[model samples]
Target: MFGSLGLPELLILLAIVVLIFGVNKLPKLGKGLGEGIRNFKSSVRTEEKTASDENGQDATKDANNT
Candidate 1:
């Protein structure tokens, strides 16, 4: 999707962000965003694993019941 954004477009976007957030706060903003994304991804992985484990257990229970 982002393949269409060339250097000029990226630079313009970056400029807009810098103007809005200022250079001094960029690092803090980036760190927070990175941490939020990491936490979200970790939770998603844990949830998927839990769902798969539940499904596996259910399948075995059904087979034994029959």
Candidate 2:
């Protein structure tokens, strides 16, 4: 639904964010956001790997039982 945002909309959103957070805190905000996103991505990857490994083990167990 939000896919239609263009340059003006982005600029206005940025302006609002700047007004809310102030320029001095922007760097810290960006750093925290980056770190949070990185942590989230890493956790998602770990979960996916664990799930795949479990599925593989289950399949092997089923084959041995047959």
Candidate 3:
């Protein structure tokens, strides 16, 4: 596993990325990545909320029937 990369290793990786993608594209790539992660997190939160609501309804029904 990648233990924390030291500063030199980090700079090397960054240099490679810049070479591959070019400096101008890096900002666009970073923005897209940020948006993707944000959307993923929001979707996960929504699914969790829906699941919890369904569980609550089931529990209430069981309690009423008892």
Candidate 4:
């Protein structure tokens, strides 16, 4: 439901976007948005992997100390 935006609100937003950008540009816009989201997800995953590796080392150190 997009937080506060319902289905009707989404339809209105879509109509406004179509009016502003036209139907022809929608495909390219969608493609660019998809690529941006994909890249962001990949970078976040890489960061999580690095953080987990550091955490694993810390855990090993703590175990040895005990």
Q: After superposition, how far is residue 54 of candidate 4 from its true place, in Å?
A: 0.9
Instruction: List the pairs of residues colliding in candidate 2.
Output: none
lDDT measured at residue 4 in model 1 versus the true structure, 0 to 100 = 100
Model 2 per-residue lDDT tens digits across residues 1-66: 679999899999999999999999999999999999999999999999999999999999999999
Error of 3 at 47 (Å): 0.6
Structure candidate 1, residue pairs in collision: none
Candidate 1 residue lDDT tens string, 1-66: 999999999999999999999999999999999999999999999999999999999999999999
User: What ranking emerges by TM-score with the best candidate at the front?
Assistant: 2, 1, 3, 4
Full-model lDDT, candidate 1: 0.99
Q: How many residue pairs clash in each candidate?
A: 0, 0, 0, 0
Taken over the whole model, the C-alpha lDDT of each candidate is 0.99, 0.98, 0.97, 0.98
lDDT of 3 by residue, 1-66 (tens): 568788899999999999999999999999999999999999999999999999999999999999
lDDT value, residue 13 of candidate 4:
97
- In model 3, which regions exceed 4 Å deviation? 1-3
Q: Taking the tens digit of each residue's C-alpha lDDT, what string does model 4 give over 1-66?
A: 479998899999999999999999999999999999999999999999999999999999999999
lDDT head-to-head 1 vs 3, winner: 1
Which pairs of residues have clashing backbones in candidate 4?
none
Ranking by lDDT: 1, 2, 4, 3
Between candidates 2 and 3, the lDDT winner: 2
